[model samples]
Target: MAQHDDDRRFSLRHLLGLVSRFARMAAFGALASVAHAQDAVSTPAGPSIALFYGANPPIDELARFDVVVVEPDARFDPRAHPKTHPAWFAYVSVGEVNPHRSYFSAMPRTWLPGVNEAWASHVVDQTAPEWPAFFVDKVIAPLWKKGYRGFFLDTLDSYQLIAKTDTARAAQEAGMIRVIRAIKSRYPKARLIFNRGFEILPQVHDLAYVVAFESLYRGWDASKQAYTEVPQADRDWLLGKAATIREQYRLPVLSIDYCDPADTACGPATAARIASDGIVPYVTDGDLATVGVGPAGQP
Candidate 1:
């Protein structure tokens, strides 16, 4: 009887030991899985950017980009649902009013300084109080109703081109700030991508979803009416400025370099070079009329 009792006790101890070992193993496995998940959440995939102003780009291709900017009114197939794409942004020029825009007919004549001969667009007087109201109620609300969740605010500083003096530039800067604040207050959740709003970046850096600058490697020379390589000095300045902006603001920076659409090698080569600097790159033609190099490094 004593021997049997001793045997039973030993069997119970072994079973308990086995159970404790499995429990420890399971706990460790769970911890490892959590650590891997945390790492994945912290380190996101590389960013991709695309800009297509032309009509009816391939929907499947547009969907591949992490973000895309397009002309909202450019007729697209209703089935594309591009207006509802989470990152598809409508292009909005804050500092210039193009005659082709729907609101141009209603734009006040006093708001214009003169035509930006390069693009045949009228520069806006950002200092005008009416402009912000027009932008919020007339320009942006219509697009919001159409389902756009974001705006690519281009030409944010085009007023600088005609400001002509330090005082005038300061006033324009203040005006831009007011407009940005109004937009943010109206739609706090809307994603805003600013195109080279460097002058006012410090005040509104946190408001930006992304900061983009054009012509890091190649660009359109309005004077020559053709594509041209960016000067070395200009490239260096822009690269350093971009790095500073990225580090200081902790904002994602995107570089849009113009290249000949027909040149197959230009797209990938420019993208690779720009990517080397830890910046997201999108190489496209000057007109931005066709899809070009995207995140995949090729068109």
Candidate 2:
């Protein structure tokens, strides 16, 4: 696991070559979302991290670690997490709205999903200029006001998938940028972090407080209740993005590679190798929804 820290400097250029291959995937929109790190954000001593799936983090397991990553729904109250854990993140996706969220009902039909691929999770229209602002004002601001340390932005690729026009793409990009700007402008001290931002890394990295490179290699399938193989392209893509984010963006990173809650996804050996890729890895279900009472999250 320690090898990634030692070899990252060497792999920087090699990974950028891989990024060139899948850049076309930007059809969704060429935008990235990032939350910048604040003074409060730091590498945990021995840097052990605790990751939780629900609105509330398992503080009992977290107290022993330097950091905790928890999902933040509108229902979540950041004040509920322990004060002793200096690094805390509010898990929210600026790219898409979950069908279960309170505000999903307020979305207009025009802003709904264009396709249902990649698990039928709801996708939104980032082309709308005000949409990102709504997320900032309504969701982000509320979390910040609650005294949360930072954000964990999931599904950033959704915007690129939904927007069809260059204009839509531009607006979509602006929307993500606006979300970051709004937060930094209001709370300069607050850290903003993003997850798995391969397609939009060029536009988004500068604003991030941290870069979360998810599933850099093979992981588990929660739905199938088994371990699964992450595509070589996907793995290469994440590796390249990680290299870019680290070298060009100069950002700290964490790897959330879900090996299934079942633990049968990747063997312990592979899981260890995932951590060696210059990230603080996690083993969770990668839950994307909050209000929906269901089995765990993503598989």
Candidate 3:
């Protein structure tokens, strides 16, 4: 009878122990849920970006964004902006040169082998050793002196349009990489934002501050000379590239979708669509002079 009593007591104690353990686990899980909810509430928002290729806009308006890309002007001073001074980036075309550029007159004729008739800018032979030096010293240094520490490097792979063969394209790609490395070496603190340098992204992703691409949903069709919907094939290709950039490299992405500046519905709707893909979206006209709708659908 004593043995029977002891066995009963052991079973009762074992059941109570299990109940206690389960209760502890349940309480721990509940606490974790509460912590996660708090974290969701308190986490800071991502960078809000704006791009304006024109000269100075209202500093108060530009200060609204976290990052702003503008055309380099000798007169524009970032320090004069509001307390929430946006990180200003100067627009620099790496794969092409415009006739209006101060250094354009000095470019060797051989370096201007191709012309982008759409924008009336000449495609540069980035492979030339002289090009990177000229660019760093002549083009970028003067802007740096003007207190512009950030650069929006555009048309990085536009040389591919004129590259005759795979080998030629690879050489151009290598040259572009050299230019990027040179920039980083020269100014380690400069924020470099690349505009669709997808070919060389893997090589320079670590050096970049942000990877920006255009035409996710809508953009100016150069061939058609109209603002049109981005074809599905092209859209899918860009979407895949963006996803890999975000998922694999863990980099922030910005996408520009061109819409009529006057089309309020299109601007907000397109911005919303691009934002849905976890990218910062700026829907503006091709000129990019007007401040348009942002990811929040705010103008």
Candidate 4:
């Protein structure tokens, strides 16, 4: 009888232990679900207003938005600028040579194929392994020292404009991916934003915090010096692609449309359209010389 009683006791204790373990696991699962729900709820509904390629606004003005993208050499004191919840990012041209910079003179002229002279920026051979080191030393480090929080890497798709063949394009894309990965590894905490590099976004998406598309809905006609709406087909294609990135990668999409600031209606209309697609939008002039706060009381 005593033997049977001992067996019953052992069995009961084992059952109790199993029930306790399962209860603990269930509690943990519930807590994890709540945490994930909170994260989703906290995600920003829209991107904060941002400025790119312009003179720095006064400290008070700059504090109005959530981010500021500007040229690396732009004269501004980031440290002295009051924290307006804005994260300042310096611009770095990834695949183009700006003649205005003395550093371009040091780079071999051979690197530039001179295919597109529209922007007065020469497209460089991204496949060249030496470019990454130069960019880190001259661009990334300097911006970091200036107290900038991150980088706005541009011209990533310039190679596609100049590439003559599929093989050449693939090589250029691979090179860009390598350089972006290197930069991410070097500065893990820095926020990196790529401009209109949708072709290579899949490969480097993990390394980037945001992707910006310039001239999305509207583009500037350099010859006419007027704003023109993009074709419906192009708009549809871009919106579809942006949706995929946002859904699959969970990265915020930022849209920049060029328009005449004097046309008051353009800014609000563009912002509403972009926000409807769940993307952040900024309407600015072609040169990006002036700042547009977007309709009054809107950020």
Kindly report which residue stretches of model 2 are placed more than 4 angstroms away from their true locations once superposed.
Answer: 1-49, 74-76, 113-119, 164-170, 220-225, 260-268, 286-299
Model 4 over residues 126-243: C-alpha lDDT tens digits? 8887877777776677778889878888888899777889999999998888788778777889888888888898788888888888766888888678899999898888888788
lDDT of each: 0.83, 0.61, 0.83, 0.77
RMSD of each: 8.7, 16.3, 4.8, 9.4
Return the TM-score for each candidate structure: 0.81, 0.69, 0.83, 0.80
Residue 177 error for model 2, in Å? 1.9
User: Best candidate, TM-score-wise?
Assistant: 3
Instruction: State how far residue 102 of model 2 sits from its true place (Å).
Output: 1.8
lDDT of 1 by residue, 1-299 (tens): 99999999999999999999999999999999988876543332345778999988676776677777888879643335745443778889999988988999998899998678888899999999888888888888888777777899999879977899999999999999999988888999999999999999989999998889999898988667799999999999998888778789888788899899789899888887777676778899988988878654335
Q: Which ten residues in a row have the lowest lDDT in candidate 2?
A: 290-299
lDDT assessment of candidate 1: 0.83
lDDT tens digits, residues 1-299, model 2? Answer: 68986588558766776676567455323443112232122221124444576644445555555555566653556566546654777778777776777677777768775654556567766666677667777777777887786777777767777777888777777766666677677777876667765556677666677777556665546566555667999888777776677677777666655544445534344445554555544555546222111111111
Q: Tell me the lDDT of model 1 at 143.
A: 82
Count of backbone collisions within predicted model 3: 0
**lDDT at 149, model 1:** 75
RMSD of 3: 4.8
